[model samples]
Target chain A: MAHTSNYILGVYDDEDVLLKAIKNVREGGVKIHEVYSPFPVHGIDDVLGYKRSRLTIVAFLFGLLGTSLALTMQFGMMTIDWPMIIGGKDYAPVPSFIPVTFELTVLLASFGMVGTFMIISNLKPWGKAKLFDKRITDDKHIMAIDLGNNQLEESAIDKLLKDSGASEVNKKTL
Target chain B: MIAESAIREPLVTGGKTVHDVTEDISGRVEQKPTKTWMLAMAVSLATLAVGGYAVMRLVWDGIGMWGLNKTVGWAWDITNFVWWVGIGHAGTLISAILLLFRQRWRMSINRAAEAMTIFAVICAAMFPVLHMGRPWLGFYWALPLPNTFGSLWVNFNSPLLWDVFAISTYFSVSLVFWYIGLIPDFATIRDRATNKISAAVYGALSFGWDGAAKTWSRYETVALILAGLATPLVLSVHTIVSFDFATSVIPGWHTTIFPPYFVAGAIFSGFAMVLTLLIITRRVYKLEDYITLQHIELMNIVIIITGSIVGIAYITEFFIAWYSGVEAEQYAFINRATGPYAWAYWSMMTCNVISPQLFWRKKIRTNIAATFVISIIVNIGMWFERFVIIVTSLHRDFLPSSWAMFYPKWADVGVYIFTFGLFFTLFFAFAKFFPVINMAEVKSIVKATGEKKQA
Candidate 1:
C-alpha cells in the first residue's frame, strides 16, 4: 500500500503550461495515480489517455428502465386493476402513455449521470480538499500528479517540477 | 515579427483585478437604495400585493372560482402553465445550447435567463398544484405510490401526471444548473463579502471553492453534462406539454403538429422573456460592459428563428386540418379564424409573427428599447397563442351540445395576474440579492474575446 502522506509532485502555472508538463510526465512512462485541478482543462483527457466515458451508456440504460416502468404502470393500471373507460375511450389506451414515459426516461437518465459522475470524481461532502496552495482557484492553474513515490524518489519530482513552470512545488500524501 | 503581431489586445483592462468582479456584482447588494431601486421596489411590491391577494383568494376558495367548467375544464390555468413553461425555455436554450455551440456572446445574458427560468417555473407550478378542489390531496395525485384507500392506481397514461414529473424535473434541474454556475462566482463574492454573516452565508453556498483546476473542471463537467441533458428536455418538455392536449381524443386538440409547434412556440416566447429581462436588468444593474449589444443581437437571432417556426407551425396546422378532411379539425381552425376569440388569434399572429421580424433590421435589433418592447409584445402574443388554441379549440368542439363560450371570471384573471406578480416579485428579489452575471465565466470570456482581438 502507498504511504498516506508520501511525496507527490505538483505543478502550477496556467492550464496550457501545466498540460504540457502532464504530457511530458506521462511520456516519460511515469504512472499517475490521479490529477487534481481547479478547473477542467479541455483536451487533457486525451493526454491522460482515459477512455471514452461510460456515463452515456449508463444514461441509456436508465432511460430503458424508465420506459419499462412507464409501460408497466399504464398497462397494469388500465388493463388488470380498476379498468374504467373515461371519455369513451378503450380500456388500454397506448398513445396516452407517451408523455409520462418520456418524462420518466429523462428523469432516470439525469439521475444516473449525476450519480455515476459523483462516484468517478471521488467528491464527498465536508472532506478537507488537499491543498497544494489556495490560489489554485484564482489566476494560478495547477496540476497535482500522484507520482508513485513508493518506487520513485522525492528528489526526481523536485527536479521535474522545477524544470516545468511550477512557481511553488510541494510533497502531498494521497 | 510574431511578437509584435501578438500584442494587440490586453487580457484584462490595465489594473483591473479579481476584486473588481466581486465589487461590480455586489454593487446592488451593498449600495444604499437608489431612486431606481425604490421605484422598482414600489412597482414589484404593488404587483406582488395585487398578485398575492389574488393567489390567497384562489387558494382559500376552490378551482371553481375560475371560469373552467365541465367542457372546457382547462382554460386560463392551462394558458398560464404553457406560457410560463414556454417562458422558461430560453434560459436553458441560451446557456446550455450556446455553450455547446461555443458562442462566446452568450456570457452577458445567460445567468439572468437562468434566474428567470427558475422563477417562471415557480409561477407555472402554482396553478396545477393548487388548482384542484382539494389542494391538499393534490399531492396524492402526483406521488407515485401504491394507493391503498383509493382502491385504484393513479393513471400513468395521464399527461397531467406527465406534467407533474416534467415541471418538477425542469425546476430541479434548472436550479442545479443555475446554482452550479454561480458557485465559483459565489465564492468570489464570499471572499470579498463585507460582513462576517454575509461571508459565512456566501462562503457556505460556494462549497469552499478555491478555484483549483479540479473544481472548475469538475464544475464545467457537471455543467456540460447538465446542459447536454437539459437541451433535449428543452424540446422534449414542451413536446410533452403539447401531448397533454394532443393525447386527448378531442377533435381540434388531437394532432401530431403540436409537439414541434409547441416546441417552436416555447422557444419563441422564451427568447422574448429573456429579451425583456436583459434589457431592463442590463440598464438597471449598469451591466453595459458585460451585457453588450452583440449578446442581444445573438438572442434576437434565436427569437427570429423560433418566430418563423411558430408561423410555419400555424400555417401547417391549418393545412393538415384541411388536407386530412377531418371535419371537426377544419371547423376548429375555421372557427379560430372567424370566432369570438378572433381578436386574440389575430393579435397572436401580429405580435408573435410580425413583431419579431423587426430583428431582421440591424438597427432595431441592436436598440435596447426596441428589443425590450418587442419582447413584451412576444410575451403578450405567446400568452394569447395558448388562449386562442385552448379556448377556440374547446369553445366549439365536435359536438355543439358541448360548445360554450369560455371566458375568465374575475377570479381566473386574478389567478393569472397574481401568478405573474409572484414571478416578478421573485425576479426582483433575485436581481436585488444575487450577482446577476456569472462573473468568472464572463471574466474568462472577456479574456478569450480580448485574445481574439489581439490576434
Candidate 2:
C-alpha cells in the first residue's frame, strides 16, 4: 500500500497567465494536482472544480448544541439546585436566560467552525507541511500537476507547460 | 463600442503590483523599528508605568483610593469599563459586518482594527475585575464553576456575570480571527526570511500554511462563517453591556431605548477611535496607497449616521422623561443638563451631537485634518457620554437624603491613562512586528487590473 506523488510545478509571474494556463491544461485532458499562490486568485476554485464547503452547516449544528446547553444549565442551576430570589422574580427566569444563551451560541459556533476547518485541512500543531515551492508564498503563482495521474508523455507535458507561459517548470516527487 | 459612463477608482492607489504589495507590507515587518515607533513606545511605556503605580496604590489601599461613595459606588471605574468596551465595537463591525456586505475597502484597515478590538477589550476587562476590590478571587468567583463554597454557583441572572462570559468570548474569538488572517502573511514572511530564527518563528506562526487551493477554499469558508457569527456576537456584546444598566430600575438607567441607543453610541465612538488611530498610522507608515482617502470618507459617513442616531436617542430620553410624568425621571434629565454636572453634560451634547454635524459638509468629511480632529472630539465626547450616563443618573436618586456628588480622585484619572498607554504600547509593537495591511486580500483586488495590464 505504498505510493508516491509525482508533480510537475509550473511557475507563473502573473495570475492571469496562471488562470489561462490552468484552463488550457485542463482542456488538454490534464487533471491539475493543485495550485498555490501568495494570495487567492478569484474563480480559481471553479476552474479547479472544487465543491462548495459545508462549514456553515457545521456551525449551525454547533450553535444548536450551545443553545440547548445554556438553557439546560441555567434551568438546572436556578429552579432545581440553588433556587433563590434576587429581583423578586421567578426562580427560573426565561427572560434572563436569553442573553447568556445568545452569547454561548455564538461562542460555540465560532470555535466549532475553526476547529472543523483545521481538522478538514489536515492541520496539526506538530505536523510538517507539504511545501510545493518556496516562491509560491511570495509573488509567484505556482500550479502543481500530478504526473502519475496523467497518461501524457513527459516531453509532451513539458511542452504543454512551457507553451502556456510558465516562467519555469520542474519535476518533484513527494 | 460602448462607452463606460464612470470609471471606478482602484481600491489600492499607487498602482502597486503583486510583488510591490508583498515588499511594501512584509518589508515593514522585516525592517527595524523606526524612530517614530520608538518615541511612541517610550511615551506609552511611561504612561503604563504611571498607571501601574496608580493600580498598585488602589489595590494596596482598597477601592477607597478611588472616589466611590456609597451612593455613587460605580463612577469612573464603570464609565471607563463601558467606554473601552464601546470603543472595541468598531473593529468587529468593520471586519465582520463589512466583510459580509462585500466591502472590499476593509481589506486595508481590518487587521489594525481587529487588533484594536483585542487590546480595547483587555483594557475594558481590567476595570470590572479591579473594581471587585479583590481581583484575584473575582476572577474565579465570576465563573460558574463547581467550587468548595458550599456548592454555590454564580448568579446566571446577573448581567455582570454575563459580561464575564461576553467579554472573554469576544477577546478570544477576535484573537483567533485575527491570527487566522495573519497566517498567510506570516507564511509570506517565512518564505522571505533571510535568517533561520526569523523563518522558524514566522513558520511556526503560520501553522504550516502551504497555500494549496483546497486549503484556500476552506480558509475562505471559515472566514465567512466566522464573520456571520461575529456580526451578531458584536451586537450582543454591547446589548448585554447595556443590559447591565437597563435591567436595573434606576430612572435614567431603566429604559427600553438603552439597547439600541448604546449600540449606536458604541459604533459611533468605535469608528471615531478607528479614524483617530488610522489617520495617524497612515501618516506615520506612509500607507496612503493602501489606507486611501476613500476609506476615510466612507467611515465618516458611518459616523454621521450613528452620531445622528445617538443624538436622536438623547432627545428621546428627555422627551420620554417629560412625557412619562415620572418626577424622578424628569428630575434626573433636568439635573443632567442643568445641575452641578452641567459642564460634563454640555460637553457630551456639543461633542457627540453638534460636532459630528460638521461631517455633513463634504469639504469637512473628506478633509484629513478635519476628520482627524472630529475623530478625537467624538471619542472625548463618548467618554463624557459614559460619564454622563453613570454619574449623573446615580448622583441624584429618589431620596434627597442619599444624594451625593461623586468626584474622581487621582487614581480614577490614572487608571484611564494607564489604558491609553497599554493600548498604544501593544499597537506600536503590533505595527512593528506584524503586517499592518492584509497583503493577501489586497492582492485579490489588484488581480483584475493586473490581468488587464498583463494583456
Task: State which docking tier applies to candidate 2.
Answer: medium
Q: On residues B1-455, what C-alpha lDDT tens digit does candidate 2 reach at each position?
A: 01122365667777688888889989999998888889999999999999999998988888999989989989999999999999999999999999999888899999999998889999999899889888977746897776565787788889988888888888888888898899899989988999998888888888888899888988998999899889988988898899899989898898889998999999999999999999998998899988888899999999999999999999999999999999889998999999999999999999999999999999999999999999999999999999999999999867899999998899998988888889999988998899988889888776543223423
Residues A28-55, candidate 1: write the lDDT tens digits.
6566655544345566666766655666
Across the candidates, what are chain A's individual TM-scores? 0.84, 0.93
In candidate 1, the second chain superimposes onto the true chain B with a TM-score of: 0.93
Q: Which ten residues in a row have the lowest lDDT in candidate 1 chain B?
A: B1-10
Give the best candidate by TM-score: 2
- B343-434 per-residue lDDT for model 1 (tens digits): 98999999988999989999999888899889999999999999988888888756679878876888888777777678877887788778
DockQ versus reference, model 1: 0.26
Candidate 2 residue runs with Cα over 4 Å from true position:
A1-4, A124-127, B1-6, B449-455
lDDT of 2 at B112: 93
The TM-score obtained by model 2 is 0.96
